[model samples]
Target: MTEDASPRALITGGSRGIGRALAAAFAADGYDLVLVARNEERLEAVARELECGYGVDVTTVSADLTDPDALEEVYERATAGGAVDVLVNNAAVAVYGPVAETDLEAERDQVRLNVAAPVELTKRFLPAMLERDSGHVVTVASTAGMRPGPFLAGYHASKAYLISFSEGLTEELRGTGVDATVVCPGPVLTGIHERSGRGSRWLERRFMRSPDAVAADSYEGIRAGKAVVVPGLRFRLLPWVSRLLPRPLSRRLARLIIDRGDPLESDR
Candidate 1:
């Protein structure tokens, strides 16, 4: 398609990491971009870079999804130009350490961003897509969602919610010219883990794949119409393999991985 005629994609958390990488992938394939993030400066920079490199239209909307009003603002600003052909619910947050010790409100905000934001955004965008009889919704869940996540209990549960959220949509949207894909990536070499306060250099180097790798895989899978995508080969199989083991042992294994190779606690 021509530049102006190209489809548009709105990606939450598109200022950096997987979101940005996915933006690049879509732009390369001739899609315009609407990027959402909290940092205005960062969002603009990515928009500029993508526009300069790909010659596609790029718009930036800075909003924290945890806020109740943010979704309305995003819907208004994002759809202003035209219909969003693809909505990537890629923004999310997590709290490390024990749940009781972690701030309750912060955990709640995580739920809002991880769960509510996507649900609301989907509600807003999917209708337009359905009316047009075309669109895609891609949500980035995590491999942690497939199993137990200990130190990151809130994060783990939130991802599980996303997995189910996307899958339910998948079944509902079939044959409607609209599709949904859920991306379940393992530890990715991004600021999300560090921002979560895990901040493990070993986790960065040892257990993680680059966000670009995941983004590329995600884009290809999405194009080929795959319903579920796990970015890495090892991470793809880990979830199902863990299921064969007992529940307690599976939880411990998940804990060990999330701990980024730290010593494990005595099994409860």
Candidate 2:
């Protein structure tokens, strides 16, 4: 495909936060969008907003990706458009407590949504991208994936799996024009914190970037076919800093920084 060709981007979790910003950014860049999320009302609202604001075609699919049955449907829904020029694997769930104290079903949902769903989606969509020899797959992993998270263990592990999977796929498609880029962003101002029963206020004070900033960086990196893009300076420094510290020290530091009290208790 040429530069002028109108690309189509499929983004998971596109109703709000980083996913919504990515969708809007892609629409502004002249890419048609297929936005997937579980909330139908919110998704439709975003679709209308993007269509009216950017003059682009916006499709919305409402499905819970945590269920295996829904995963099959989500895969089909994802590739419904003729050709997906870009795939943004951004749908994820997070649990913020000690592993033993966390609910088992919630942990399973994290694995299903964050790990299995993306892997399956890539397997389904990447073949056509490889054949076409001109497409990009961007997985929104996290800097937390660099090490074992003391509190958010399941979420961290899932992201680490996603990063590893993306890296391996990039190597596999090295010669092919199909590129895979992994984005390791630290906490951004997203609904994730609100949903995880946590808050972004502390992170906001420290190094939390806006969804718009993260989205912009992601678009450029994916377009340039960069292997990995870390959005902000502080977040970019995290993985390296974690590497330099002793394993136990690193875990302790992570716990201290990530220890957000019950998000539901906020004065909303």
Candidate 3:
């Protein structure tokens, strides 16, 4: 905590979508922000908007999270302001298509950004929060983590790791002033689908939880000290649906969608 009593939050991929939505939530709560993203122009725009709208200081860090060197720089910049009160691990990438045919380099980059970067950032910032005995770590994962998605294998696996990691941290940090929460949103209207080159309209219709809704739900869960927070009423039934169908049926249905239906076809 800073002497000024203003809390600070550091969010990766804060320029758009869920990251941007969460940023608004934090800013509204009067937390100064450090918004990080690869696009300098977009990051600065978001920073300016939040500062203007919420009347809180905003710092923009433009760097690629997948790059280790850039991450160190991000740490320096984020802490220069003060100890971060909230750390949002919201940046992630989805690599679609058959695993064998996907670009190996892209897949690795996704893993580095989606899985390794959050761990690295937490390692850098979480200890200080623990020492102070006050902070929150919110990961924006997905409901896809609960079940297999054939065309989105890497993305689904990465989200599962996030869910597991956050849930474990939630248990480990109990009684400590810090808490860990993973927000699982099924699908939203976002550039992620287009960027992944696989916007499945059929899937999106199943759960239309907006990024803002996810952020709100995340806050509710975090305040309640919940380990896992699945936003959207419709999406919350996902596990039930997955369980009712046998594993074979669930997998086969996914295969049908990816094969005959081609869920990878971007409706965007």
Task: Evaluate all candidate structures by whole-model CA lDDT and list the values in order.
Answer: 0.86, 0.83, 0.84
Full-model lDDT, candidate 1: 0.86
lDDT per residue as tens, model 2, 83-133: 888889999989877777888998888998999889888888888898898
Off by over 4 Å in 1: 1-4, 201-204, 260-268
Write one digit per residue (lDDT tens) for candidate 3, span 94-126. 888899899999999999999999999988999
Considering lDDT, which of the candidate structures 1 and 3 is the better prediction for this target? 1
Clashes of each: 0, 1, 0
Deviation in angstroms for 200 in model 1? 2.9
Error (Å) of candidate 3 at residue 118 is 0.7
Worst 10 residues of 1 by lDDT: 259-268
